[model samples]
Target: MRILGIDPGYAIVGFGALDYTRNTFTTLQYGAITTKAHTTFEDRLSEIYDDMTQLLAAVKPDAMAIETLFYTTNQKTVIAVAEARGVLLLCARQAGVPVFEYTPLQVKQSVSGYGKATKKQVQEMTRTLLKLPAVPKPDDTADALAMAICHAYSYRSKQYGVALTKRQQMGYF
Candidate 1:
């Protein structure tokens, strides 16, 4: 299965693509779609939509995994991220890809076997799982890769009829 993972943001939308087969992963690509600060918000969103459309066309992934929105305190920031995520999801839906959402805790648990794993731990585990010499640059890029790994692991378990808990089924650790 080919899976595309996205970490959506207006300024920087990170993406990672992977092919999973026979219990192995092949990293296809990993990068970020960056928008300039000088650009208008509408223009930035358009750019993101266009880039995501092209990425979907290029990767042709069977499934897409995205990080679910989690807000700490800033309502304005949360709303912006939510808008970005909406565009990302629209692109995936238009491309006929099944989208699965995962939380930060779920991603950490899937990648590091610990729900409370630190960001560094998740990044290191993602690098190790992909057999990379070093962690991917730009923390968002690594986070995207971790999202892909989480989906791959969860999908594999589901295919084997492993009865994951409701929280796990809902992509929460």
Candidate 2:
């Protein structure tokens, strides 16, 4: 299975593409789509949409896994992120890619074997799982890769009818 994981944000949207086969992962690509801090919000959205459209075309992932929004104290930031996420979803829909949503807890649990694992812990586990030489930079990039790894585990568990974890046992369907 080819999976693309997305860590959505208006400022820096992180993306990672991976191919999962026989319980192993092959990293295809990982990077961030960054919008300038001073750009107009509308312009930022446009940039995100355009870049994501091109990315979807290039990756052609069988599934797009995205982090679902979590509440934050800053309404402004939350709203902006949500809008960016909307653009991402639309891009996937137009490309005919199947979309899956996962929360931070699910990602952490799947990657690090702990639901409340620290960000550094998850990053390290993701790096280990993918057998990368180093942790991906720009924290969000690592987070995106973790998301991909999480989806890969979930996908395999479903395919093999094995509940590897509590999340898999409950079923993400």
Candidate 3:
């Protein structure tokens, strides 16, 4: 299975692509789609949509794993990120890629075996799991890879016909 993980943002959308097979993960690509700060908000969104459309076509992922929106102190930032996420979802739907949403806690637990793991812990664990020489740069990129790893693990559980508990089902939600 090919999975694309996304860390959505209006300024920079991070993405990582991975191929999972027989319980193994191989990194295919990882990067960010950045929009200039000087650009108009509408233009930034248009850039995101265009870049995401190209990414979806290039990666051709079977599934897209994205972090769900979480409460933040900055309402404007949150709203902007939400809009970016919406564009990502739209692109995935248009590309016929199944989308999976994971909370930050779920992603941490999946990647680091602990829901309360710190950001550095999760990044370190993600690096260890993927056998990367170093943690991916631009924190969002690392987060994106973690999201991909999370989905691979979650999907594997389902692939083997494992029964999910109520809480696990809620994780999918």
Candidate 4:
């Protein structure tokens, strides 16, 4: 299966594409879609939508995994991220890609075997899983890769009854 993972943000939307099969992963691409600060908000959204549309067409993923929005102290930032996330979801649906959402905690647990794993731990694991010599740059890119790993594991857990850690086995579904 080819999975595309997205870390949606108005300033920089991170993405990672991976192909999973028989418990192995092949990293296809990992990068970020950056919008200039000087651009109007509407133009920023347009840039995101256009870039995402082209990316979907190029990658042709079988599924898409995205991080759910987490509440933040800054309402403005939260709302903007939510809007970007909405566009991502819409694009996925329109492109006919199956979309799955996971929280940060779920992603950490799915990839690192602990719900509270540190960001560094998750990034390291993501790098190791992809057999990359180094963690992908621009933290958001690494986060996107971790998201993909989370989805891959989640799918495997369901399809093969693969065992998660005791903590994860409790309420993962």
For all predicted structures, in order, the TM-scores are 0.92, 0.92, 0.91, 0.91
Q: How does model 4 score by TM-score?
A: 0.91
- List, residue by residue over 33-95, the lDDT tens digit for candidate 3: 999999998899999999999999999999999999997899999998998899889999999
Residues 130-152 of candidate 2: C-alpha lDDT, one tens digit per residue: 99999998998999999989998
Task: After the best TM-score superposition of candidate 4, give how far the Cα of residue 79 lies from its true spot, in angstroms.
Answer: 0.2
For this target, which candidate reaches the highest lDDT against the unseen true structure? 2
Model 4: CA > 4 A from native: 160-173
Using TM-score as the measure, name the better of candidate 1 and candidate 3: 1
Off by over 4 Å in 2: 159-173
Clashing pairs in 2: none
Shift of residue 23 alpha carbon in model 3, Å: 1.3
lDDT of 2: 0.92
lDDT of 4 by residue, 1-173 (tens): 89999988999999999998766899999999999999999899989999999999999999999999999799999999999889888888889999999999999998899999999999999999999999998889999989999998897687657766664545443
Alpha-carbon lDDT, every model: 0.92, 0.92, 0.91, 0.91
